[model samples]
Target: MTISLKYRIALVVFVLQVAIFSPLLWFTFTAYRDADLQQLQTREDVFMRLVSQLGRKALLTAEPTDFQLFIAPFSKDSHINRIILLNQSGIVVASTAPVDLGGPLPVQKNERNTVWKTSEIANATEQLGAITVHFSRAELDKKVEALVKRGIPIAVAGIILSALVGLGLGSLLTRRLKALEQATRRMGAGDMEVTVAISGNDEVAHLAQVFNEMSGSLRSQFDELQQVQQELSFQAQHDPLTGLPNRLLFDLRCSQAIATARQHKQLLALLFFDLDHFKNINDSYGHQVGDAVLRCVAARLTMALKDHNLIARLGGDEFCVLIEQLEQEQEAAAVAESVLHMLTVPLECEQHEFFLSASIGICLYPRDGDDEVRLLRNADTAMYRAKAAGRGGYRFYSHEQTSSVQERTSLEQRLRKAIERGELRLNYQPQVCLTTGNLVGVEALARWSSPEFGLVAPEKFIPIAEESGQILAMGEWILDDACRQMQKWRRDGSTIPRVAVNLSALQIQRSDIATLVRRTLDSTGLPANCLELEITEGYILQDADRAVAVLQQLRDLGVSIAIDDFGTGFSSLSYLHRLPIDRLKIDKSFVQEIGSTSRAAQVAQAVVSLGKTLGLSIIGEGVEQLHHANALREWGCHEGQGFLYAPALAPDQLHLLAPFKRLP
Candidate 1:
């Protein structure tokens, strides 16, 4: 039932040989027997013709001896079986067989012998008798047997040769087929690299070639799929903008670090921070610049920390760091400081230089919170506190700060609605010419009177506005309101020479302040010269070159620029001279400590000298005492503004007061 190809092929060949040679051998044997029988028949005919001629004499003589002599020769040749001579009376006169010499001619014929009868043997006048001859069939059988013996060996050899050829051809095909099968099996077992060797141009070879091509294509596709999977996994866990680990990945690593810390009873700290006023950068310059800034920040943060520290972008401007196996909590502070310092460097994007700062909050393991959730929450709380405390610093988590942070959050929400609720207004304080004791200009200040929390001070709310991005809108409101009030005062015949408006660092850095000033002046129909814009000394020093350009633009619009809170920041004198400023306002703290502290007086004197030398006027704020005013005047200070002159007052009240009057 089940047969190998070799055996099957051999059997088929054997069957074909037998079918072909069997017929051929039988035909050869049959032809040989026929030829031999034809010769035997020819000899019998000749013998009968001869006997007819020769037997006449014997029949005439009526001698048995004569008949015997004529037929004896043929009988001895082994072909003639018998010969008989009969006379006219139908009796056997002569016979080759002696027993038949006296008897009548035999009527029975032998089956194995061929009988031939001759015409009558007669004399000249009448017929005498007939002669009969018999030929043997055994010689034909002998010739056929000889032919079969010669043909059998050749046929057997031919059959054997055909079987060998069939087996060899079968082996050639099966070997290649077996190799392809093995290669296919290997491919099925996940070895896609396997290939079959092709030998000939036959179908099996073609099949092997196709298999090799398929294996290579499959391997290529599998490699591409694996690469795509790896890329997708990386994209899933990383920030697309910064290439830093995303929030999900950060949380996972933080949780793992916490576990390790817990098991080892080691200290770890979680630090959270975000860039201050980063939104302003995005709002002012476009997201392209914002994204570039974020990338730079991520790179700087990575460079700032140790290799073991894990840093991640929690999204947008926020980032977190996990510091494990810390020796002390103070180490976290050092790391935070390094990070802040690294951020302080100028970031250049699309030809615009930016000076950035961050407020960082750190929380230690077990001391602040046990788990990542609590730790991150507390760190975020501390960061908000750092932002509220004027930003550009770091704070450790404390239980006391949480309530205040919550309150700040509530206040920020209320402040967002403050402008719509009409809870905001402006007050103007009088600025006097110290030499003439006459009112010159009034400084405009923002005041918020909330229905829920009445009369919040500028000190409490301004920083909140700046940090929460509310300052941009508030700054616009203040500029418009101040210009409107100044115009109103002018309409009332109040000769307030100029109105000074304070500019937050956010307003200057995040927006085109010069353009806003021009728009406000045009809208209010006020002269640009009647407005003085005050910026803190520290903010100007952040990017002195950009600050100088912006101040120059404002000055070109005919508005006066003042450095508020002067001598407080680390300002380079080289940059001080480059500033397009009209006045330097001594910080209120220094002004208040003028008589109490010699160092404060000396700093105030130095500022006055610097301002005068730069051809700019000096204004001393918080000149509460008479001696403070006298001391500032003696130092060549041009103007003063404080409670001594007047607290910031309502526009109507200020209009009621004489514009040129000296306060008591």
Candidate 2:
């Protein structure tokens, strides 16, 4: 029902035409009628004048022929209906009406009231002196009728043309508005394919242009939002550093695998892998090095497993692998072994080489409770059991192993309590010079005088210490105990031998190691020269720069540095030349076969030559026989530590060492 602008304009124009022309048309018709009437009256007057002239000529000359001449001219005027002449007595002399012309103007009707004289005329000749004229009014009435008939058709044609123009314009404008409405609806429903087709320099066309631009902008924004959403989803399910599936993704895969295994009556195995002493690597190196190590581990695990198998990082040093559609448990074990072997090889990072290892635990579906949570927990328990069986190995989930895991877990809890109970003590093993038979140094060894466990082995507890980050505390206690022993030796008028304390990978890589060492030496009032820090060669080779810096700081404090288990590493003389080392302790593996095999003798001789060239002393450890000692001395090794001389002893056992003769 809405009206378009063109229709409304046309309607207004029509209304104005009617308002103005109705009265004008009425006036024109009246004027036209009056003008025709006036023309008729003028024609009648001329004819009457001609009649009067003829009658007057006849009266003046007494000639009827003159009258005939003028009357003939008047009769030729076609617009006149009749003409008549009347005397002063009101008698018609000549008449266009036949009856009125021949006799006295019989009673004059209102239409024929134009007479020559009225009642004022008296004498017969004066009053009856006649002038007659005649004319017809029918011609004037026909002319006015002709004008009205011609005007009516033209008016009708004009109205029809105006309507057609209005309709055409209205249709064009309304269609554009309709198209705009449709496009708006489509855009509202999230479709940008619709476009309003309006081409002109008018307002509606401009509106259409704006609408198209709006749709384009909205579509672009929607696309960008979708991309951002996808990126967020990727980050949520994947580890940012390793680009591997994270725990959330792992859980989802685990659930799906479990469901499929149940349906097929097959088994799914979940392998939980924990990096052995991974934190010690971080503590010995830096977190940057730790991240690199993790990336390397992830790469190795990925390569070991098949494409269908799933591997995911469960955060930190923990990762999980799911083996689906496996034929047997051995298949999963084979994969775990491959991972273990590949990871055990040295990982080279920024010129530092590291021998990384993993402890793997396997749990099977249906047997380990076919659920994600149960599988994950069982796998974790089996992994700890693997670590307990000595790390860099794998263990399968069994109900029997549960008791052992619980016992180990309980032992860890008690070990924490032991520190508070002050049950831990230190023992010292003498480092004897092979040639001089003098006690050159002592290696401080930690022992747990546990009230419950009685005595615990270092191998059993040190892994626990490394895992729980309690090694830092245990290391601190060792330092304190060693410094105290040095102070006691000095107070008793005995010359103080250099006390070598082993530093865990974590302890030596600490940035504040220098401060901690200085404080420990100060607190015990032990001379810095009497303290020697023994670090494993594996940790030092991981980051030579960091290791050298820490060693230099210790050296600057008047303390000595030695690389323990030196021969077993990828020992490059280039790195050794850069290290501020005072001694190189040959690993027990080489020392055990010394003087027994040519290969062992050659390794021992090479180490002695390398140590002498680097201006570092060589100490051979685990020399259990006299020939072992004699061989090391002949090889020019400076010191030897073995059971042949003395085992690591308690503080109270020092008197027994005093009575025994020193080794030659």
Which candidate ranks first by TM-score, i.e. highest?
1
How do the residues 512-537 of candidate 2 rate in per-residue lDDT, one tens digit apiece?
88999999988999989889999899
lDDT for each candidate structure: 0.84, 0.78
lDDT of 1 at 623: 85
Expressed as tens digits, the lDDT of each residue in 155-183 for candidate 1 is: 77867776777677677668888788889
Where model 2 places Cα greater than 4 Å from the true spot, the runs are 1-175, 274-306, 337-357, 384-393, 400-417, 432-441, 451-454, 589-620, 623-647, 662-664
Q: In candidate 1, what residue range of length 10 has the lowest lDDT sum?
A: 655-664
For model 1 the local lDDT of residue 407 reads 81
- Model 2: lDDT of residue 125: 58
Candidate 1, overall lDDT?
Answer: 0.84
Write down the TM-score for model 2: 0.69
Candidate 2 minimal-lDDT segment of 10 residues:
113-122
The segments of candidate 1 whose C-alpha lies over 4 angstroms from its true place after superposition are 1-171, 174-243, 246-248, 255-268, 275-304, 314-317, 324-331, 337-357, 364-378, 398-410, 435-437, 509-512, 597-601, 625-627, 655-664
Cα distance off (Å), candidate 2, residue 350: 4.8
